[model samples]
Every structure is written in C-alpha cells, then in structure tokens.
Target: MKKKFKHIKESQLTITELMLPSHSNFSGKIHGGHILNLMDQIAFACASKHSENYCVTASVNKVDFLNPIEVGELVTLKASINYTGRTSMVVGLRVESENIRTGEKKHCNSSYFTMVAKDEAGKSAPIPGIILTTKDEIRRFARSITRQNEGRHRTSRFSSKIFKTDAYIHLLEESNSKIELK
Candidate 1:
C-alpha cells in the first residue's frame, strides 16, 4: 500500500471550558492536574483524528504552568500535530485562559504529547505523514526532530550504566547543595 499524507489542520482540535470552583486548588486557582487531563484528552483526540485509529500517549514533553487560571475564566486549548513518524505523532497543545468579565487573556501552558497509534491487536500502527505547506508548519516539524534528538542525547548522557558521577559532581558545587562523599 502507498503511504498517506495529511495536512495538520485536517485533525486540529480546539476546546474551551469554563473553569469551575471545583477545579480549583486550595489556593483558589484552577488545578494544574485538571488542565493536564484536558490536554491529554485533546492530544488523544487530535492523534486519533489524524491517524484514523486508536491512539495512546507515549510521553508528555515539557509542561510548565506559566499562568494561574482562576475560577470563572474560560480556558481554551488548541491541539495540532507538529510531527509525524512512522507510528507516532507529536501533538502540540496551547492553553490560554480568558477572563469572562474583562476579556483579558493569558497564556497558561504549552505542552507536547507524543502519541502512538494502535492496531486492533494493540501493536504500533503506521500513521499518515504530514504535509507542510507553510513555513510555520515546517518549523514545528523541524523543532520536533531536534527535540527528539536532544532527548536521546540527554538520556544517554545520564544513563546509569555509563554515567560518570565525577564528571557531574563538580557542576553541583556551584549550586545550593552540599557534597559529602562516603
């Protein structure tokens, strides 16, 4: 069979929900966990739509809560496929919160979720490649490739099997830490 290609916008998804008091933490801000759950759901939806198959999250990249969402705000999340491998895709998510009364908007989070399509037998399945027609789409694809390469390099450098403690111990001296060798 020939390989299939799709445009990123074909499967793009956007969802908006009102922040409720129940979703807030003790400090009265919307809980980070709640936002994360919504992000994961959108990621799954986007990936599934793009692949036309059931998908599961393989990993979640950096998630930093840049702004606190308050109760009564409208939280909107947008998801799009940034990169597509043979069996996996990177779903880019952007989260923003808007004050319903004042109409002020703030960026809350940006995250990347890696999802893999699954076959009926629960094995990895091939997914369609993405068509990059615009410069922004090309940049996102290239960024995903760079991120994956950096992750591999970081993992290998810190792998327990070959990691050298001495090489990193000196670096910790500059931080707020005390080194006591046994």
Candidate 2:
C-alpha cells in the first residue's frame, strides 16, 4: 500500500479560553498545570485529526512558563503537526495570554508533545506523513528529529544497567546535595 501524506495545515488546531479565578493558583496567577492540561488537549486533537485515529501523548518536551496569566485574560493555544513518523507525530504548541481589557498579549508557553496514533485495538498505528510547505515547517520537523535523538542518548546514558554514578558524582559536588553512598 502506498503511504499517505497531509499538509501541516490540515491538522492545525487552535483554542482559546478565558482564565477564571477557579483556575488560578494561590499566587493569583493561572496555574501551570491547567495550562498544561489545555496544551495536552490541543496536541491530542491535532494529532488525531491528522492521523484520523485516536492519539495518546507519549512524551512532552521541556515546558517553560514564560509569562504569568491573569485571571481575566484570554488564553489561546495553537497546535500544529511539526513532524510525523510511522506511528507518531510531534505536535508543536504555542500558548499566549491576552488581557481582555487592554488587548495586550504575552507568550505564556511553548511545548512539543509526542503523540502516537492508536488503533481500536489500542495498538500503535501508522500515520500519514506531513507535507512541509514552509521553511518554518521544515525547521520544526528538523528540531523534532534532533530532540528525539537527544532524548534517546540521554536515556541510555542514565539507564540503570549502564549508568556509572562515579562518572557524575563529582559534577554535583558544588550543588546543595550530599552524596552518601552505602
């Protein structure tokens, strides 16, 4: 069977919600966990739309909260297919918060979610490839590949079977931690 491909725009999704007091932390800012939940939802929606199969989040890349969200602000989350593998896709998400009264917008977070398409039997399923139409799309696809490679290397380096504590023990000496090897 021939492989199928889809343009990045075909599966793009965007959602906006108004922040409320119920979603804020004790510090009066919108909670990071709430934003993360929204991001995951968008990622799932984008991936499922592109693959036409149910998708589950396999991993989430680094997430940094760049700006605090006010309770009355409108938060918008945008998701797009950045890269696609045989059974997985990287959904790149960007979040921004806008003050309703002033129309000022601030970037709150940017993240990459790795999602795997699943068949009705709950097994991983192949997904359509992405059509990179712009330089930005190409760059994002390249970034996802690089990130995956780095993740594999990092995991192997710290795996229990091959990890050497001594090799990294001295590196943490300056930190506020004590090494008590039994």
Candidate 3:
C-alpha cells in the first residue's frame, strides 16, 4: 500500500492550563519540570496525530527555558510536526505564559522532541511525509536536518573511544570546574 502524506498543519496542537500554587517551586515560579512534562505530552499528541499510530519519544532534542512562569499565569503550549523521517518525526514545541490580569504573554520555552511511530506489535512504523505549506514549514524541515546532522557529528566526536581527553584538557583550564586526572 502506498503511504499517505499529512500536512504540517494537520498535526498541530495547542494546550493551555492555568498555573496553580502547587505547580510552583520554592522560588515561587512554576517548576521547569512541570513545563517539560506538558511539552512532552503535546509532542506526543502532535506526533500521534500525524502518524496515525502510537508514538513514543525517541529523543528529546534541546529545551531552553527563557522566562519564568508565575503561579497565576496561564501556560500555553503549541506543538507541530517539524520534520518526518521513515519512522520518526521531530515535534517542535513552544511554551508561553500569559498574565491573566494584565493580558500579557511571554515566551517561556522552546524545544524539539523526536518521536517514533509504533505499530501494534511494538515495532517502529513508517510515518507519513510532511506536506510543507508555508515558508516557515520549509525552513523548519531544513533546520531539522541540520540539527540532526549536528547531533550525530557531536555524538561521534565525543564517543568513548574516539574522544581525546588530552586535546580538550587545555581548553578547560579557563573554566571554573576542577578536573583531577588519574
């Protein structure tokens, strides 16, 4: 059977939740872990929507927290399929927080999650190709390829066997970390 293609917009998802006091940390800000948990959920939803199968998180790419979310704020998470491979798709998620009283919003975080479609037998299943409808969609697809390549290069460079501790030791001299070599 020929594989079906899905548009990037078809899998887009948005979720908003009011932050509560219980969600805050000791510093009176919403805990980063809480936000991450929400992002993961949205990523799963978006990936599953596109794949039409059970999806699992293959990897979580980068997550950068920009602003702190307050207890009284409304946190919103938007997710979409950025890129699709044979069986994996990168789910891009953005988190924003809104102050209900002032009606102001701030970007809280942005992250990318790699999700793999799964079949009933718990094997990886092929995912549909993404239909890029906008310039941003094209840019995202290209960026995803670059990001994946960079990650692979970094991993290969730092692998246990290939890594050169001696070459990097000198570069760490200016840092605060104290390294004791045996």
Candidate 2 vs. truth: CA RMSD? 0.8
Error of 2 at 13 (Å): 0.7
Candidate 2 residue-wise lDDT, 27-143, digit = tens: 999999999999999999999999999999999999999999999999999999999999999999999999998999999999999999999999999999998988988999999
Q: Which candidate number would show the highest lDDT if scored against the true structure?
A: 1
- Model 1 has an lDDT value of 0.98
TM-score ranking, best first: 1, 2, 3
* TM value for model 1: 0.98
The global C-alpha lDDT for each of the candidates, from Candidate 1 onward, is 0.98, 0.96, 0.94
Question: Which residue pairs collide in model 2, if any?
Answer: none
lDDT of 3 at 24: 94
Specify the poorest-scoring 10-residue window by lDDT in model 1.
Answer: 172-181
Question: Could you tell me how far off, in angstroms, the CA of residue 19 lies in candidate 3 after the best superposition?
Answer: 0.3
> Could you give candidate 3's per-residue lDDT for residues 99-171 as a string of tens digits?
9999999998888999999999999999899999899999999999999999999999999999999878889
Model 3 scores what on Cα lDDT? 0.94
- lDDT (10s digit) by residue, model 1, range 1-182: 99999999999999999999999999999999999999999999999999999999999999999999999999999999999999999999999999999999999999999999999999999999999999999999999999999999999999999999989887897899987779
Clash totals for all candidate models: 0, 0, 0
RMSD values for the candidates in order, in angstroms, are: 0.8, 0.8, 0.9
